[model samples]
Target: MKYQYEFFLPQNPKPIDTITGDIYDCEKKADEIVAELGINEDDDLIIAVTEVGNND
Candidate 1:
């Protein structure tokens, strides 16, 4: 499944960055991506489910 992963900082109303892809590409990759950029435990990761391509 595909998803939109958003990385947000504490007290922020919007995400700093967004990544769209499958679990491995979006979720896992986002983890590694943010770990290097610097963040604290107060930060949040919001996952939004999305469908890519056509079902029919």
Candidate 2:
């Protein structure tokens, strides 16, 4: 018997990664800046945050 196997499936909405940095109140700041600068598709802003290691 012959059969086809596909492990990976295509996602309807592709995921994207946004660069972020260390900061407090990230959500509030992201929103504030988005509005203040009138950001659009033509612009990109990097968010900041702290990173924790698995050993920690």
Candidate 3:
């Protein structure tokens, strides 16, 4: 199994364009984005994790 991380802005119900437009392999990479973009809690950004590939 594998996982991918993505960041979304303003909430999850919106279209993907609302995303931060980046994909990360791990939480640490995502955290780097938070620092780089100066994202705060008030920023309404979301870090979503999704499963990828197949275990088989």
* lDDT agreement with native, every candidate: 0.61, 0.38, 0.54
Q: Put down candidate 3 lDDT per residue, 14-49, tens digits, no spaces.
A: 423222222434555656666776777346557566
By lDDT, the best candidate is 1
> On a 0 to 100 scale, what is the lDDT of residue 28 in model 1?
68
Number of backbone collisions per candidate: 0, 7, 0
**Any idea what lDDT model 1 has?**
0.61
| Model number with the top TM-score | 1
Best to worst by TM-score, what's the order? 1, 3, 2
**What local lDDT does model 1 show for residue 15?**
74
- Candidate 1, residues 1-56: lDDT per residue as tens digits? 55566666657777777777766777565666568765443355544455664323
Off by over 4 Å in 3: 11-25, 41-43, 54-56
Query: Which 10 consecutive residues of model 2 have the lowest summed lDDT?
Result: 1-10
Candidate 3: RMSD to truth: 5.4
lDDT of 2: 0.38
Give the root-mean-square deviation of each candidate in angstroms: 3.4, 15.4, 5.4
